[model samples]
Target: MRIRLLGGLEVTSPDDRQVRFTTRKTSLLFAALVLAGRRGHRRDQLSELFWPGRADGQARNSLRQALVDIRRSFPPGEHATTYIDGDQDSVALIVDPDQTDISIFDLKLQSDRPSDLAIAADLYRGEMLAGEALADGMDEWFGPHQNKYEQKAQQLVERLSLALSQPGSPEETACEGLAERLLASDPTAEAAHRALMRIHTLRGHENAALRQFELCKALLKRHLGAEPEAQTTALAASLQAGKAGDLPLTAPKANAATGPKPPAPSVSTPLHDRPSVAVLPFQNLSGDPEQEYFADGIVEDITIALAQFRHLYVIARNSSFTYKGKAVDIKQVGRELGVRYVVEGSVRRTGDRLRIAGQLIDASTGAHLWADRFDGTLADVFDLQDQVAASIVGAITPKVEEAEIERAKRKPTESLDAYDYYLRGLAAFDRTITNRSSLEEALRLFMQAIERDPEFAVAYARAARCYATRKSNGWMIDRAQETGEATRLARRAVELGWDDAIALSYGGYVLGYVSGDLDASAACIERALVLNPHLAAAVGVSSWIKICSGEPEAAIEHASLAMRLSPFDPRLFAWQFNVGLAHFCAGRYDEAAAWAGKSMRHQPNYPSAMRVAAAGLAKAGRIAEAREMVARLCAFDPTLRISNLAEILPPFRRPDDRDRYIEALRIGGLPD
Candidate 1:
């Protein structure tokens, strides 16, 4: 008896008769069971996987039907002869290890023998579970395994091609077949094109080699709207000049000591006036292709670490990751992103061992200022990433910067899945164009991350931030209930991520603005500044606390610091609004009006910014502009009035400041 799961889910009995399940769900269940092996899956888990969004009883019923169908696909068996062993609570697979093709494939992948390697190569007939699409949420659970199998297939190709690419080997001819097959699946694979060209050049087939280069060029132009990387183009040029031996036939191994390290270029006009950087997504060189997510996560972690540096202006991940799967020139990337430096790297993993190679390049001169390689076990992966980030910072500016080192070393969660969910939440939160749906979705994703890892403090902070975002967007339906929840989440974030400036900043901001706990918010933000010192949003929100305390002069300085820390931060508009409040408090009505109008341009419907804009205009004697802002503010939030301001706003310590705001609002046509 044999079962197949790599390419498609199929079963064959001892008699060699193919067995088919009645439905895709049944096949999926059986495949899941077999993959589980000795570890039993709970009935509730299966029900949720197969019938999500259905009523509990209905989901359970559907799972039972799928299980029955799966059991029936077994050979005409008597009692206790089934592959699946199940009680009411859980189900397990009882099949022999040799009876499953995927089990054999895994064994071959782990084995060292060339014979076993060849066997693994033969087993991958096509994409894992070809033509398969699971239920909506099931895809997330299923994708990693699919990637795992696909990675195995790629490893088989690379290993075999390399081994056979050498002279006079019996397996040499198989290299061409493998390269062509890989290219057919992923035509944009520049490496595969190079491999084919190298194979032809090795055999002295110059015509074939030239044809391969032409094919690569056409495919790259048509599909990616670009040319090949410098190495590929150089290889083609060398081959065309009949200097095939000069071409780099083997892939460049990332060795920190041996490779041609770019010398640090002389500093002229620095990348920008301020230290600026773009971090490209690290290439996944981990033979197990499924580890691409881990590579991506590393880049994200490094980006966050770099962003925390107040001295360095970092491009957002959205802008940098746009280069993924594209052939890019470093100078072009610098020009497009307006950055001086670029950090690029590759990640490799073998069993428990891990290797990360990183390079910090001056994008202007394409000169590497620094390059390093880290070797460690899987458990030390985060520490390695931290080292890389800390190293880059030290290379960029070797100052009195222990605080920057500490800032770069913070870890949000130990669980990679939790980190992935948190990133999804961040993406959702980033798109809140004053809409309720995106914020709601962000909350859901953050909640999922929390469910995956309860101690994920950053997720809790982000979840809290969602409520604050809703409040800011005038989308809060139950202010009291939401304020309590927001306060609770923020407290948890501070408790858990005690040293994380990101968590603390979010916690402090929500506490100040949404909970209106001026003292607590001020204290938390002050502590956060001590922790990171460069946290822009924290400084901005700290100014809000100062505004409430009626220290207009101090508030103005903090607001300016916030804007300087991150001029492009979406929340910088609120920081600008705080500056307007400071100006309005100091009787500088003209400056207040200008800053208020600037805030209004960024966040058109922000009730508070709008109120300040209207009030500032009225106080400046701009009656026509004041009336327009007043009308817009009333239309944006009709329920807002003078009496409710006390409950909604942080209390002003100075009576004159409070009176002045109310008087201006009243003059601007806001109801008293």
Candidate 2:
């Protein structure tokens, strides 16, 4: 019999008749034995692994029955018994190791010969046990095996792509197929994408190669919100310049006779904690020499506005303006300025009409991230300049952050520095779900960031927010310790980052919520707003502070402004929740419930949204729906009680506001 277990379990008799097990467990057990080869599993171990907590006798009997089922799977009189032999203590599948596809795959991989490696590359149909439904504990058992095989497949594809670099050789064709397969399985496989680009270029299909680069860029952006790596970008640039013929496909790999080869040369790129951007002086499209000053003024204003954001590194006006009135390469400008992003534009005037157009491009890949134009009359030139500057700053800040977050996500965890870890923590914390585990992970990463750089103010600020998240979700254990930690982190953040608007905003919010220090929180957030009024997060937190301070109108207005500032921000749900809370405080129960529903749609498990929806619904006389929301709330926080509201919730500045919220929740059917 021939059995294959690489992709999924498959059994074929000597006569080529297909054989399948009726029970999934039996098939899994059989596959396990096949992987085990001659030295099989002990019966007791197999029994407990598959049928946990069962009586010893019952588990042993089940194992025996499974073995019998495996034996009967083959054709009658084929003596399948010889293939499966074991003493009472252990079960073993005795078959020629070569008969199994996995063994042949391993054997071929060991051979330094290119042909054997090619065969090994073709043998990986997919991840081990592909499409096979694994039982709960079984996945834990199989996970290591799956990871090992997946890594092996990745190695094989990369090795083949490097070893077989000839233009039209059979080995090259096989490498192309393998790279394609790897990409199909993992769209974020940059190595595979690079391999395909090299392959297409070697085949004299330059356009196809360029298209492959575009595909890779889109895939990275769509899935990871990141740009291509520097080396990949360089390859694409070389291809565009028609110099790909001189490019080596890869660093050498182990040859049939030679040993392992040297590593590829590293590409040089600047390392910055925050993404850097340069706003080049806009070209004066108008024929009038007076229009040159207009373009320059607008670019200068934009550079200043962008510099206000703490997370961005905006190039100085003098440096950027040196390229004024000259045609410049975006990539060269980026390299010279040590920036990841470049903003270029043109200003045109036709009689009294003014039109200014701008585009944001990734400096490394030359990919345009955003583009837009504004039209107005030059009647109020300064007003138009301010409007356009604000518009550009607002539009590109979020885009830059998105790209940076994606790049951080793609960085190897083993090599991460403080800033990379902080970015990763930010991404995890921004998840709409707001789950406990994700919050925990965000906290862990932020603490790691702090460990790498003790004075990382923003990291401390975000780490405090993670505790606030846990408290909001009712995931906090050992309340005093967590509360103390959160307060310390917040205080340290504010102390260290007095000039950083983002740090102050995040830290202030955490302090206000956890420590109930409304005055200090308000002062910090107000300072942050003054520092960077266009910052959506600062604005959002300011709105929450307003809600706590009993200024419902100001709260709603700030929340609205925050939303308008970054319409696509991941924290939109929080702003929506803030609006709901302000309306609830203003006693608009129905409207509050509606807004809470909207927030829940964006972030389904947001604890504040759930509470607001339940209380507002009950106040609006929607008892049935209110009870349903309460049921979900209780499921999410099983320990929640009306009596301990102050422990879990932030204190309202007005005592009546707190009492009103408590009364509403009590009426909503929350358990005492």
Candidate 3:
């Protein structure tokens, strides 16, 4: 038996091989059998699936005739059995699983085993039986399946090409052969052409690469009547110019090769001249090793408190803590960390009389910006932390203006108790991912903070964010209810704390994810950024908004800024995922894969990051890898599917961007 699914659904048998059933009802029966796999459809189910409008007796009679035609068209022992019919029971395809090209193609595409690509390539016969006609009823049943298989074939071609192009690969021959076969199937496939060009270039045949370009142009003109995209044109030109070897692979640049060289630390410019700064772990000069935690806590407090200032960019605690015990050069550290200013300090506890020494250095010039010492009793520890934050903010305020500084100082609610609760909630929220119970505890803490002060916008915002996470991760039993509460809390946060960066950022993110209001989310995130440039969360969320809004370049810029601002962020996975998503939307699949890989490295179990990575790999034509990642992602979040992705995904204003994601997932073989 032969099954064709590239264009329309069909089944053929031996002897009378031309016995084709072009009617919609006949085709619908075939599609239903294929989709159901080995499970023979019940007689009632078959009748309903194919002849839903017909009477029960008529539907059953029609199904029986179709089966009889299938068996009669191909005699027994000549071809594999095409149908398995049981009296008063069900019907199914008795053919071997591998006999159906569509099934084989999907299996090979999803397999990560070494020989999968070759298997997938061999199974794709052509463009799914193009130009075939079926009844309206059958068209509805088979159209999507046909398109999906064709897409899967195209994706496999891409994967085969990339896999073959990598240096020192045993599969190089296999990849080249696969690319040739794919091109034969769809002569105008630009991706296949590009892959061939890369292979030729890698083999030292530059002219061969140029010839591939010409072939692409000819095929496009003859078939689709189009030209290669700008990137393709540029690549061809580079090959012609004998500079094809200079093309960079899709990988992150390695760190500096030389040893660490610390430049002089001195203040040449004031702290206000810089957009962002990082305060490394403060040294413990109290002689007792137990004081290390105290010193570290001081740095954490100062970082968090200063991060609240709208004008000054403060590095996150995780990134800053990376330098805890290492004696590093300040200027090199600044350059590597992408910061313009660096703060170093030491804490001394002498019989409860705490003495703290702090120095701010200009990273660009390796000069000291300011140096100060604070001596007070242990009871003044909290005050000392607040004073440090205030001093840093004051030093950085000149970069904006006196009026802006005054306005930033304006408190939305003058309640120190509320502020403390908010801070505690933040501390808990940051650690909420450690365990399921921790998440519940964190939610409770956030609720407590909100209950203490109904006007505490930041607390409400954080609470909403936590709830959103629960819903997104499938931790909540009632996603609709949790999401509803999250939206309400986010709205309240935005309403109550117009000037609070945390409130605006978290509220905007929740609204974007749950409400699908791109414009409102964008406004909130933009406002948050204006309120606090150092707010990494706001910057990261804004980058995603930009991508979804069809502004990939802007999204990349914002995501880069977020990375620079929070180099050691514990949640760096989120930032990396944002960058990858932007790149994927822009059709830069290689870069997207690289960034997504980084995100996965940072947090292996992050579902959102995994989804982005899978999409990136699929777009880049790494089919086997993409399939593997998709399987992992599906296993991690079983609720994911092509039909529901749009609803679950953050809003993308452009239809094309949304389609790109959906198409990528389809090609990646997302499970139904």
Instruction: For candidate 3, list the clashing residue pairs, or say none.
Output: 6-128, 7-128, 7-129, 159-621, 266-366, 266-367, 266-368, 267-367, 267-368, 319-568
TM-score on alpha carbons, each prediction: 0.44, 0.60, 0.41
Query: With candidate 3 superimposed using the best TM-score fit, by how many Å does residue 36's alpha carbon deviate from the native?
Result: 51
Error of 3 at 385 (Å): 24
Error of 1 at 395 (Å): 17
Error of 1 at 105 (Å): 40
Q: Tell me which of candidates 1 and 3 scores higher on TM-score.
A: 1
How large an RMSD does model 3 have? Answer: 24.7
Per-residue alpha-carbon lDDT of candidate 2 for residues 304-323, written as tens digits (9 for 90 to 100): 88898877888888777666
Candidates 1 and 2 compared: the better one by TM-score is 2
Error of 2 at 512 (Å): 0.2
Residue-by-residue lDDT tens digits, candidate 3, 68-182: 6555654446544555545566566666776577777666765545467767776565666455555456666555555556555555655565455455464556556666766
Clashes of each: 0, 0, 10
lDDT of every model, 2 decimals? 0.70, 0.80, 0.68
Model 2 stretches astray by more than 4 angstroms: 1-273, 284-294, 347-356, 373-384
* Candidate order by decreasing TM-score: 2, 1, 3
